[model samples]
Target: MTMPTSLCPYRMQVHHIKQETPDVWTLSLFCHDAWPYEAGQHALVSIRNSADTLRAYTISSTPGVSPFITLTVRRINGGAGSQWLTREVKRGDYLWLSAPQGDFTCAAHPAGRYLLLAAGCGVTPIMSMRRWLAKYSPMTDVEVIYCTRSPQDVIFADEWRAFPVTLFAEEGAAQGFIPGRITREHLACIPHLKDRTVMACGPAPWMEFVEEQVKSLGVTRFWKEKFFTPSAAPATSGLKISTLQPVREFYAPVGATLLEAMESNKVAVNAACRAGVCGCCKTKVASGDYTVSSTATLTEQEIADGYVLACSCHPKSDLVLA
Candidate 1:
């Protein structure tokens, strides 16, 4: 069956909850009907209570492996959605979720060799791709490097042992694992780094480091997914945005994302995965000078043609969006 539309949210029952770590839990959700999803795509999950909270989570389950989909969530100290999923939700609980959406997937860009780097909970999407590759593309050579605080904090550690995996622990070291943060020296050890496709996911800092390292190696094909919205620097100028569909205009303060600015002014815009990894908030720019922090979901031509991701874009000057 086809996936549900973004404008429509589907209800899924929690089939089971598995605790991978003290702070991380995996929730298996069963839909009333079949829903197809690719590995590495994420879904926007919402908790319908007094306060409606929505957040996007990467799917960790491989397609066709089971009748249900899975989301692995890590509890953040003050994060409402993460805390709800980890502490409040349970089996038989129902959640409203959007269809699978994101561009970070092996199916989108196939390669002969892949080096997957993940830190903390960022391993979710990479693990999905790994499972899919094992079942569908056995001939492909894949290597995974997962970084966490310690061995006790690693998610799905036992399952990852079956593959070519390397664990990097910062606080402590263990046998068959590296100690300390990932560095350029570590990336230099990989053979023919430029010839392999490098996909890294995790916090913005970790992904930025990985991106710089990959660029230094002259890697042509590199993909990255950040779970959190990028922190934008203070803007020097304000923005004037004009929308066409509803025919509205508004003034956005400097350093504010277009999505945030529009939402604050009560402008309706469907957005999911505000990190810019999902293309849900893509809009045509009628005219504007803007700076995008991340372009993982956009093509080079699209940027040239005045297309921007509203979630991660900061206005450099006055803007008009179509």
Candidate 2:
């Protein structure tokens, strides 16, 4: 499907905001001209801050629901964006948003059975896909294996239990639930994993671990969706950053984010959502090597093209940004 224009016309108003966890809040938005987003797609939501700075978030709600989109935000200590969202944002507040955008989605495969693996808030996008399938492709059998630290950390606990689901809690469960992380043994317990197409979304380590475990099972069509980028270090000196030139090079700090480092060097990169979820600030790497943060938004082709999100990427070594 074609994406919406750069300047989104839809205006969203916060209908309700509720605390789901000690650090996470569910913000529901009411929008005009219902936004068009496919399953697993994310919208770039921007909220006005005290100094008029805009903070961006990803739309967690499925687009099938008219006029409403939900966003789940996890509070990060010492984060200006998190602090503003939790402390200053109020119900009925209006916010600006870009058209929904994201490439992490379920490809049309005629596979009869499927596996959905998710961790923490990573469940948001996968939930969208699940809802879509439930809406349009009811016969597509699905099995959800969700992992979290404990029952309290489960984001969509009640809703998931109502479906064909397996819950894995690390801290321990009261029975009918698996304890600890998703290990190879847990995967082995699932029937027909080899015949099913698996879609995984979570932290990088989680994705890597599951991908590795499932590889030996002869599952060739495993797809991964994550919000975290791979780790990267600062860029070296004597480099330039811009979109005009097809060839570019720059320096980035180990701890300093790619956006922060690039902006510090006066590079013009668009980053509506500083968080890794939004794909803005994504650029082609062209050549050289680098790493991503907790959230990764690179496609297989983009990865081949050396593309990277300047917002979440840090330079692991001196590299070029095209």
Candidate 3:
């Protein structure tokens, strides 16, 4: 997706890289600017080799720390972004990043008790929160439920020990870790479960399980920010879209996202969290209609002014870009 010039990128050098687990690695990028961001937010990353290919990776380092930002990546067998980050990149390489952007942060409200749940590399962002909490709200009550394949593959194995963590595994055994997925029994074990704000991140199914299990246990303040890039086949009756600046035109499927359609047609538009959580893809709708799944980062006033987040909206009529 095209990135906005105002939010173009901060060029940072790769300071260090560490293999966190068998298939997971952490990249520590040297921060040249005083890049400010909350603990749980993620940045849009892109290397010069593949400038147009950007992916979101959460910042695992705390903002309180300077000169560095860490991103923990889990290698996915067929995943292009993760694989490149974990294997292809070398030390001292430069990476372009959009300013940290996301709403999945607890920095503003740090005094409350929290229940952090993570699986696999989802622990990346969770670690940021834990670090921030430890540094700032040192007395705040916190509990964690970390899951992985086995003891051998637990990311940040020793770091999580500082907090009250319940480990769940789908395979081999460990003394303190359980041997199955998170269940109702586990939620019931955490003291004051109903009062703690629950935050979970992981695979869709695992997150779904966490949502259902936690709500069933009477928890209402649940927070999770998932970066989902929705996909679909372009419709046979293709709908056309036009961009303003240079008057570019393209045809997008009826139900397909307007942003995805533009990307397919090589139209330049910036998108951070393809899920509409970040408003980087905001575009003025010069003269057409579209449907939206969530208002997300747009204000009611902005909607009245014809601004739409291209990622979440589908073309209802032929669109004219402003």
Q: Judged by TM-score, which candidate is best? A: 1
* Rank list by TM-score: 1, 3, 2
Off by over 4 Å in 3: 1-6, 49-51, 65-67, 108-111, 227-271, 277-322
Model 2 poorest 10 in a row by lDDT: 45-54
Off by over 4 Å in 1: 1-8, 49-52, 229-271, 275-288, 292-310, 317-322
Candidate 2 per-residue lDDT, tens place, 33-64, comes to 65667777665544442223344555667656
Per-prediction TM-score to the true structure, in the order listed:
0.76, 0.72, 0.74
In Å, residue 110's CA in model 2 sits off its true spot by: 6.3
Of the two candidates 1 and 2, the one with more favorable lDDT, higher being better, is: 1
Candidate lDDT values, in order? 0.81, 0.68, 0.78
Give per-candidate clash totals.
0, 19, 2
- Please, what are the lDDT tens digits per residue for candidate 1 over residues 45-97? 86443223467889999997645799999987766678899999989988877
18 in model 2: Cα distance from truth in Å? 2.5
Q: Pick the candidate with the highest lDDT.
A: 1
Error of 3 at 270 (Å): 9.1
Residue 179 of model 3 has an lDDT of 94
Candidate 2 vs candidate 3, TM-score winner: 3
Global fold similarity of model 3 (TM-score): 0.74
Model 2, runs deviating above 4 Å: 1-9, 49-58, 65-67, 107-111, 229-317, 320-322
- Candidate 1 positional error at 210, Å: 0.7
Ordered by lDDT, highest first, the candidates read 1, 3, 2
Clashing residue pairs in candidate 1, if any?
none
